[model samples]
Target: MIRTFGFPELLFILDGAKWTVLMSLAAFLFGGLLGLLVALARTSKIRPARFLALCYIQLFQGTPLLIQLFIVYFGLPIIGIRVELWLALITGLSLHASGFLAEIWRGSIQAVPEGQTEAARALGLGYISRMRDVVLPQAFRISLPATVGFMVNLVKGTALAALLGLTELTRAGQLMSNITFEPLKVYATVGLVYFAICLPLTLVSSRLERRLNARG
Candidate 1:
């Protein structure tokens, strides 16, 4: 029973964008915090800390997120650990984001000169104080563009949540397309909605990159 592609369907699809945005936000916030820890650990003086962080980053970064999500959501139940859909989605996304962010922040941290760290130490500042006062601020500025670019990728990655039966933007589009039998229209709208959300982010990221380069 095919229906017409109408404004109401379009409106419903638009409404679903809220979930996508929310999911992305949750993933980013939680992931960013965790990633900061990973970055610090990755750069830590302790060999064990670095090794463990490396394993974590490689495990998450090397694997397909779809399989990770499947393991978290489906494979877990086989081992008697029941997982919630949203929880699995957020967890998978968080791990994925954290691994990459850790590397990004780590590189940014390393890019800061050794002399600055030594100078901060000469001022009698401790590790946290040195990073807080001198190192991280600059590293953050250097890393901002890449971080924003990764965020844009994260926004697009939210579509994978549809596989979990979540009626996020992509899932909503799929359902509507089925009912309306208008794959072209529905998908075009979906792409447009994603573009509307991501295009601004892309522009801002580019502008920031240019500004960073200019300042550098």
Candidate 2:
């Protein structure tokens, strides 16, 4: 029995879209926190800290995200730490995002004028205060465009969760296609849903870039 692609099917895909959004947000939130720490360490004066942070960034950036997902979803059980599908997916995505976001923020932190740091030092600010009150604020502004761009990529990346049996948007499409024998319709709808989610972020990234450049 081939069911037509109808409103119910569309709603099902949309339901999956919600999971996609939730996962992306969760990954971004956790990743951003860890990335900030990594960025700080990457830019630290301590050689060992910088070296370790560099290696951390390289490890994730060097590997395919799918491989990361596999390692998390499959490897953990071997170590006796079983994770649910959503937890595994979020963990893998967060780690991946942390590496990329760390680099983005490290560059942004460095891009802050050296004079700004000197001024903060001259004002007798300590390392934490300097970064918290002075450097990070500017870096945050500088990083907005790239961060949003990466977020757009992250949103697309969530589709990979389908491979791990998480019924995100792409997974939803997969099940729909299987049942309806309508891969074309199902995937086209998937693509449209992805576009709907990503286009605004894309536009925002571009706008932020232009604004930053204009200010520069």
Candidate 3:
């Protein structure tokens, strides 16, 4: 009963790709908001805020993303927090993205010329106004390339969700391979799908980096 790899299989993978895109978007949206707060805390003059933000960034950056997903999906049940698969996967990915994005933004915030901050201060702008109106805008521009690069990584990282039974692209390939007994064909298609998704973002990231460097 070996089914051939055909249009149906391709459609199945595409469906999985759809979920992959959705999951990545959800993670990035939530993570970006949290990362902004963490970045602000990391750059705050308050020592405790900086210390706590540093520890958060280190915890995620220091560990494997797969482990994080496992802890969310499996470990939580032991502590009486039962999360569904979607919740666990998105939560894990969002946390991971936040850690890296926070660092990227923190550096960009600091890289904004000190004099610009001083000028804002001289105008008697409050801390919130200074960051909202001045510092964050420049930092956003400076962070674009790296942020997109990290997004590329995040898309690839979604493959790990397969381990938790999420049926994203990689899991689709696995199921297709198992049924068709055509691991090579199924996996090659998977790789192509990933390349199709990631290459444009890769090119954009490079273009952005070059543009930033030119302006520097």
RMSD of 1: 1.8
Error of 2 at 91 (Å): 0.6
- Between candidates 1 and 3, the one scoring higher on lDDT is 3
Q: What does each candidate score in C-alpha RMSD? A: 1.8, 1.8, 1.9
Off by over 4 Å in 1: 206-216
Backbone clash tally for model 1?
0
User: Could you tell me the lDDT of residue 15 within candidate 3?
Assistant: 93
lDDT tens digits, residue span 1-216, model 1: 889999999988988898899888999999999999999999999999999999999998999888888888898889998888988898889888999999999999999999999999999999999888899988988888889889989999999989889998999999999999999999999999998988888798788877877887
Which of the numbered candidates is closest to the native, going by highest TM-score?
2
Q: Could you give candidate 3's per-residue lDDT for residues 1-216 as a string of tens digits?
A: 899999999999999998898999999999999999999999999999999999999999999999999999999999999999999999999999999999999999999999999999999999999999999988988888889989989999999999889899999999999999999999999999999998998897788778867885
User: What lDDT tens digits, residue by residue, belong to model 2 across residues 1-216?
Assistant: 889898999999999999999999999999999999999999999999999999999999999999999999999999999999989999999999999999999999999999999999999999999999999988988899889989989999999999888899999999999889989999999999999999988787778778867885
Q: Order the candidates by lDDT, highest first — what do you get?
A: 2, 3, 1
Extract clashing residue pairs from model 3.
none
lDDT of 2 at 174: 92
